[model samples]
Target: MAGTPTIFLHAELLPNIRQLTLHVSLPNSASEIDIRESTITLSESCRAVTVFTLHQDVELVETLKLPVKVTDASRRNLSFAGHRVDIGGTESKAQTAEYSFRLQVDPNDAGLTFTNKGFQEDDYVPWTASDMSTCAALHCKFCKQMIVDVASKPDTSSWQWKDLPSGNWAEMMDFWHCHKPDVHPDDKEGQKDIEAQNASVKGYGASNRVVATPRTGLVDVASFLVAESDCQNIKVLEQRPTSTSAKPASHDGKNARNIGCSGCSAIIGTEDSVAEGLRLYKNNIVVKHTGATEHVYETHSIDIITSSRFLDLIDHEGVRRFVIHAGQSNGILLWAFNPDLRYSSSSADHSIVSRRAMKVLYQNATDVERILEPENGVPTPLSLEELFLPENIYDELVLSLRRSNLLMPISARIFREWNVALLDRIEKRP
Candidate 1:
């Protein structure tokens, strides 16, 4: 019989890896390989681990200690096959143990409801069960790293994916609530602001409170939906606190002196630091919740904005130098990260999009647009269409052709590439 092979996080660095743990397994094969991190490349045929030779490998009788390694520079989050890992530093206050999130399975498709809400965080709304569409919002972290898949499904080493557990389906609910600003008769101040923004929108008059995407930022889907109707909330990635530990250390002692912000990694109690972490916040929308605490952003408020405030925060008061966007089937993925985050959140309707797809689009778009551009990294959007899918994703003509499976990889890959190319072109246009 094949050896009971497994992997472990031997070392995080090529030279040194720390924090080792073993969690649950995947659903399909019971391959006890724990899928930590949300970031990874999606290959329909990629397997979760190279050691997962069979589905039964996941159902190991003893706690399997496979030597799993994190291959990307992005943060490594915690997640399993169909389930997300449940871990947090905000709540735990652990120093270096938060390596990833951990959890079991409970896929009732039971939509997330607001309980412990924060700014721009929301759950199921009894009010718009029919009018608005909802998603599971699963992912503890937002790193869009990936592992290999499908063609060599048994050995998933090549596929890349988002590995950070910044936001899972459930946490995503919180994220959605924070950014997707809610507006109703209840939120008077918020309503007033949205009303004013709504008025300034030219041509697209009906668009609601979506403040014009900052000169550098693109309008998020949640914001766009609000522009269309009473958007439940909008999720944006702005800067926030990372920890309440050691006061930020100073590299120059002048500006970095005693710098402590919300998401600081080593923030000392009352002491300040220059580092920070991400948090969810809201723009418009009247959020009213029944339960929770009283942080600037309530844990259980009716208003929610699925946003990443950490993006607004920079390293020890660092400034956001990049404001890029990626188009997705359902919406646009805004990439806004500061130096502190070390890892970044790849925005998407689903958890991630394939790197190969991004690469293919990068290669092809150069010909169609007659422009010479960098192809190594994902294309960043500078315009609205560039940020989100322009044509109805399902209706794109290019995708329709690949649906028959002629293009290598798969249809999913083709569509993802097209989205990347389309956004690149639209963003580059004046």
Candidate 2:
């Protein structure tokens, strides 16, 4: 019997863009592959088939198919032996070309929703150029860092803002009641602040309490600004504590610290004082309201801003754990198992139950088993093939981490370690 070809198909969700990536890996030589000649077709069954002719000189052809829809697609060849493609139209020695297809799913699809409270909904209001100008020149009061600027208006048409719900008195009261109970000892001042905010809300509603609204292309937590250095024009300042609204503590503590603009000693936002993991605040951020009679500027908490460092990985028990340290703030930890990959089984496994377990752990050949056992030599770098997680799961992991001010871009060193591990696994295979 002819054994199955060493072809692998995998799908991953792009966390930043909320797009689906379908990748096909072929075991054929690069000189025999020409993605430009490939044709991909999608079926009503939500499956896709790709046919490409390889080694045109010999008229050799191959077909690769998977269960997915191809929307926007592109192709690139990669060689594990450190081969680079020349841009000057020079043919180079490469062995593998990876074909990536972006899937087409409705923006209103149920799969995109995060929570019942509509936290991750796509209901964003466009931000006009004038609307962004209000806070363009403003800096943090404590750090004097330039938070926003006129040049920030890259896409005035699609850029939008969304209102984040501020918890009611009951929620706020409960948070303060439990936060640092030993330190507060007595809830007298905490109770007073809750009552005061509640009274203000009751009289003026949430409008009065909302101060500033920041705009982003998306409404996810990571969409907000995280690092003071991300701002082109900014000044750093000596760290200092800044006062904030007496709201119930969310993931971070009650007081926000270390989130000041570098350009000036202005307190733009609040951050965790210790790890400085994630910072949250609304200082000098405002949006414009176009009225029928005249232009009106108001402080609204419709949009919030934040900053944090890159992601970090730790080993717990036998499983590899991933987390984002929000500097001095609390870190955001991810769940052990990915829900999407839970039902998948490894095709290489002969036993049905073991195959099912493989699907649950690795999803497909494209899925890389998170560093289950770290090897001693040079750490392998992680690739897109290894971390191709589902969109919903990936988004939640990133959003939660960002909200806690712990979200960060994966670093190159970590990727190197993942790649090294991957090569070792491939070499060890009999």
Regions of model 2 farther than 4 Å from truth: 1-6, 34-37, 45-95, 114-414, 417-430
Query: Could you give candidate 2's per-residue lDDT for residues 4-119 as a string of tens digits?
Result: 34434444333235454455444345566564554444444443333434444434333333322234322232112332222223232133344544554334534333311221
What is the clash count of model 2? 59
Q: Write the per-residue lDDT of candidate 1 for residues 259-279, one digit (tens) a residue.
A: 112232221111112112111
Q: If scored against the real structure, what TM-score would every candidate get?
A: 0.17, 0.26
Tell me the TM-score of model 1. 0.17
When superposed on Cα atoms, how far off is each prediction in RMSD?
24.0, 23.0
Candidate 2 overall lDDT versus native? 0.32
Ten contiguous residues with the weakest lDDT in model 1? 421-430
List per-prediction Cα lDDT, in the order shown. 0.23, 0.32
What is the Å distance of residue 409 in model 2 from its true position?
Answer: 20
